[model samples]
Target: MSNELYIEKNGAIATIVINRPQKKNAFTLAMFKELGALLDELETDKNVKVLVVRGVDETAFSAGADISEFLEVRFSAEKAKKYNDFALESIEKLYRFSKPTIALIQGLAIGGGLELASSCDFRFAAENSKLGITAANIGIVYNLTSTKRLYNLIGLSKTKELLYTAKLISANEGKEIGLIDYVYSSEEIEEKCFEFAKQIIQKSSVAISGMKKVIQSVVDGENEESEAISEIILASYCSDDYKEGIQAFMEKRKPNF
Candidate 1:
């Protein structure tokens, strides 16, 4: 991975930090490729039970794609399509990552930054953070997958309002509109994020991962009891984690997942 992006593992929780703070953590195409690769490795790493994505500093989560490379990577239809495809692959991976994922927005989360956060299972932002998508301002249409994610999240009208205006909303407003799951002061955001992650890590990974897929399937318009969904439910019932959980519950002790 580039020095601008790296992963830190702490027991069951893994964090991918975007470190180009000098550019407000704006991601270059190289960085996006590195991010996509990292997610691939972490996807099957059993040691990781939760994943958190954040900028290295509180200044900004990311200013979106680096405009400096636009002339080189997005100046033509062919080039832009390739560039967007690379970035979206990573975003889609994060969206479908089996583990619980969280995006911690300490500051600005604009354009692609907001899409990154929206892809995660939870979006926690600092009270002072700002977030929005800016495709309208640049005269470019937002891609369908990211647009659909936002539509599923904030609903059609709110998604339309956000995409059309290109206005960054405050973290509180984001939370109020269901764009943000939690918000806190800069001093507390990271600490609170881990606290929540620890809580998640304490749960049954089998159940959590299975439910994550089931939820995503539902969001993607799957029926309540698709064969795949039933398989997930059935597999969970036969998991060692389920057996241990029941035993611990009867024995009045915390179950080790």
Candidate 2:
């Protein structure tokens, strides 16, 4: 993995830190590739039940994609499409991750960074943090997947306001607009994020994963199929963990599975 992204594991919780503090943790092509790899690892790593993503420094969750690299990489239309594709793959992995995910926003979360946070299941931000989608400023059209994610979180009206204005909004404003789930002081952001993650970890992993998929299905308009719900129920019933859960409950003990 590139040094641009760092992974720290703490039992059931895993934190992925964007390490390019000098560039406000802006993601480069290399960082995007590393992020995809990291997600792949986390998916199969049963020990990691919840994932938290944050920038290395409190200065910015990320200022967005590294524009410095974009100059050379996005010079041509074809190249720009390829570059965007790389980022799309990484972001989509996070969007569709089976486990519960959280975005810990400390500072500026702009452009693609804002999109990354939107992909997560929940976002927690420092009171001083700023969030915005700035694709309009760069003359790029937001893709369908990204637009859907943002619109789903904040609704079309608010999503358009942010995209059209390209203005940074306060953390509190973000929460009010439903962009972030909670806002805390800078001093308390990290503590609050961990506490949130701990609470999430206490829940059943199977149930969480199932709910994640079902929610996505609903958002994607696939939940109308009765088979979708049935599949989740059937999978849960046949899971070894489910059996263990029942045995544990009958035995009056915590599940060890």
**lDDT per residue, candidate 1, 229-251, as tens digits?**
89889999999999999999999
TM-scores vs. true structure, each candidate: 0.98, 0.94
Worst 10 residues of 1 by lDDT: 215-224
Clashes of 2: 0
Q: What is the TM-score (0 to 1) of candidate 2?
A: 0.94
Model 1: number of backbone collisions: 0
Candidate 2, which segments miss by more than 4 Å at Cα? 226-229, 247-257
Give a tens-digit lDDT track for model 2, residues 111-190: 88998899899999999999898888988888888888888888989988988998999999999989999999999999
TM-score result, candidate 1: 0.98
Error of 2 at 98 (Å): 0.8
After superposing candidate 1 on the true structure, give the runs of residues whose Cα lies further than 4 Å from its correct spot: none
